[model samples]
Target: MDGKTILPRSEVPEEFTWNLSDIFASDDKWNEELEALKAYPERMAAYAGKLGESAKTLLDWFTLSDEITVRVSKFVQYASCRSDQDVGNSFYQGMRSKAFSTAVALNSAGSFEASEIMAIPDETLARFYAEEPKLETYRRSIDKLRRRKAHILSPECEKILAAAGEISESPDRTFSMFHNADMRYPDVTDAKGEVHTLTDGTFVPMLMSADRTLRENAFKAYYKRAGEFRNTYASTLDAQFKQLKFFADARHYNSTLEASLDVTEVPVEVYTNLIDAVHGNLGKMYRYVELRKKILGVDELHMYDVYTPIVADADVEISFEEAKKTALEALAVLGKDYTDVLEEAFSNRWLDVYENTGKRGGAYCTGNGWPHPYVLLNHKDNLDSMFTLVHEMGHAMHTWHSCKYQPVNTAEYVIFVAEVASTCNEILLMRHLLGKTDDRKQRAYLINHFLDQFKGTLYRQTMFAEFELQMGKMAESGEALTADALSAKYLALNKLYFGDTMISDDEIALEWTRIPHFYYNYYVFQYATSFSAAVAIANRILREGESAVKDYKKFLSGGCSKEPVELLRDMGVDMRTPAPVNDALSLFGELIDELSALLG
Candidate 1:
């Protein structure tokens, strides 16, 4: 008999979407991985008493751990792919859920060993390295663990942290289940009379509908559902903040934000300067919103109006194949290694490109160093999809470069440096296409695309960072953040950023409910600062060419070998200063002027 098919969506194509075979030769191989993974928990448990045997034993334990990690990743990735294709698939969900539990166990077990290893006298651990040549790589990894040695407490303390991990994850887990599984929107019918359900996936398309009324209805219908869950959502976020605060205090950090950046060694100034940089350029953002008013002839622009295409049917809709070509042409400056690998990705099915009935929303590039990066995209035949392709490809290419240069031990990078390469690709693609376009309409569209990128990535993200700070401060100061407080804060900042041109309202306040990033503990700021650096590096590379590329590659190849700050310094950026952000915002103002004049 054929293997049991348990996907929520039973109508899945015969071939797995995006070729799971590339990662593993067949489903049979996936089963083998599962069997191996089932046997790993006990195998990992065997390391429990063995870690303290000697320094060599600790090193060998780590090696065994890495091998197990590789196997776990293989198991998890395959199961995840099946689930992503159809989240309702019970079989894969069970496997995926088990994989997560296994992962948590593995993490706890490793941390237990790491704590013992750190407690070993520093001089003794050093002498072990002298005895064993192969132990040097663990030296850096151990040094990092050593940084937390003080923060770590007794084995009893670690076990407490480990056991609480499941409960602590309730907020994120609740949000995902509710947001993805429970929420549904009313059907929004467009002027062409095309009726579409206003889903999180389809919300953007409905908002971009040429019909203003459709956008309005879509917004109203979507947020009505959000309104129903407001109290539950508020409670969920409260739990999340409490968890963050508890962890921060436990770790001896002064604040949660600091605790967060301590992971990447990124400075908080890099974050604040991003908000300041965008604030200094508000006039340009207002000007673009004013242009929306003038061109669309709307009496008032609303929050829903942001994604409304300012340009008419003039958009260049390229198929996925053509978009891949455009990305290759635009990223040619990154050198042949980039171009060649991207070509392989295109030909070899490294990307899951289409949106089927039950695939995940949005786009992401994810993989481990052992294998190349895998990018998942919900491709629309539009410019945003093209930019998204460029964006995710930026991440994959960065992963590619980093994997080539750094060892698996340090291959994964901080999110602080994550979006720079991706956003730079967006800027580069815009430059390439805009330079070639003589048509004023197309030029304005391209300029609008670039301007909108600044608005969403830079200005909007800073607004989010500001709100995030406020909420964290509120929670920190023994204040309760109700739905009222959350919405009020979000709407206030929404008005602050849009200035007088846009109408920021009650529905807009519901914005807080829509953002999943707020739950990430000070993560949205990275998008703002990454764009700041991307703007600087993009301009520098366009203006100075090879020298800028050389510096950028140094940053790319540097990995976690250094803190993000020093690494950015090696790339010719000083995170302590506000100059790069100032320059980027100034560039935004210039682009707004160009777009406005082109429209006129």
Candidate 2:
């Protein structure tokens, strides 16, 4: 917000940047590593038809594979993080492309391992495990692969599929380029006639402004720019879903959802159960929407008005330094051990902390058990950015704990439960802030923020999940996903979810064109599902104290050591049933009642 303009990457202080050097000493070193890695595919391919030759032979391959995995993981993470730091940096862009290509080649070379392993008889494999005790390190991974024996294609077919990995990534990569690098927006002028720069990072903060004219102008302009390229986005999405369908069909799965869920051993029922639970609670959402409209005193509510705080006087700007302190204090409930690691994250520059020219919009956390986890953030001096900080740190801390506790092979957690830790962090921060205040306006403001979490994370994400499913089905039924067809379906979903409380503006229909998650086959549902689980977990942590914290920490360390659902179930939230979602919705209803009483 300094001067209301994004600084160039060179202008940003080094202290505020992430330390990618920890992954590679320099780009020359990275290139050196990259050059060496190009030879691995041939080396790995030489091991074909020999996986079942002996126990030690299998163990040797596993050891070499694990070593290469750690190296490749670091390569990809470093290149991508550098590229994301400034999407317009051509050097890092090419590095990222090469890293991905080498990764695919390596994967294609190892495609024979699965079929070869599955060819080993169950009894023979059990004996092999007994013969080589070190092989026990990979018992879970072996079991998981064997569990999918039916889906294991021939080595040649597996290689073919593996080779398609880069091509399948085209949609997401294209969208990222279009969104972060190529896309441009006109300057937005405020009610005071002050011209403010508009970018992806600024759009939401603009909507949160109290000035209605600014909010409306920003929203319409942003979407109008996106609308111009609607057909291109539609084609990319069509190709994405078709690619997903191709893989699902090849693997003998019934639908894209089944293929996606089966990878992490999640039940298809979990997805359906979320939609059903949210549908049952639509009345609560409608009430919230109605309450928001009443509080704003608007003749008619538009999508642009939805983000502005209903409590006007309580808007407060929080500095990044203050946000760090607040986050530490808020997370203190997790114990000294956890807070110590958090301090490390702050001090060691694990986070790239502000937006710069050509930086990728939004935020993410990525680490692969190398030195430590790294978080990318466009830090703003506002409540939402603080929440984003803690959310991503939640992911970073989860990565830290998992890497420390599990081996490289098992340390990586699946996407299913990835949001739980982050959401729990936000809930804890909300509790800490809410506990610190009792004034009517302040309490109402905090409550409204909490309500927005449910609306955004739980309701909106589920809406997206539903749209993803419907889109997938449309593709499967042989429908062309033209821009008009896609927009109509999206607009209808908006109408269904928002009900009669707000106008289904035409600009909002093009909203789908801007969402990067649509390219990620069925990735948004976890935000909703995990939010429900986090509510239960966060409530228990505060209510039960140390015992709950102990269980939660263990869950964080669990990585993919167990199935994701079982990890949460062991911690006492059963995602397999609707209980968690229903419980969270009940709490949402209660908060609405509280906000109503407080505002009254």
Report the number of the highest-lDDT candidate: 2
Q: Which ten residues in a row have the lowest lDDT in candidate 2?
A: 1-10
TM-score of 1: 0.92
lDDT of 2: 0.92
User: How many Å off is the CA of 111 in candidate 1?
Assistant: 1.5
Cα deviation of 475, candidate 2, in Å: 1.5
lDDT (tens digit, per residue) of candidate 2 on 91-131: 88998999999899899989999899999998899999999
Instruction: List residue ranges in candidate 1 displaced over 4 A.
Output: 1-16, 25-31, 38-55
Residue-level lDDT for 139 in candidate 2: 92
lDDT of each: 0.77, 0.92
What are the candidates' C-alpha RMSDs?
3.8, 1.1
Model 1 has how many clashing residue pairs? 0
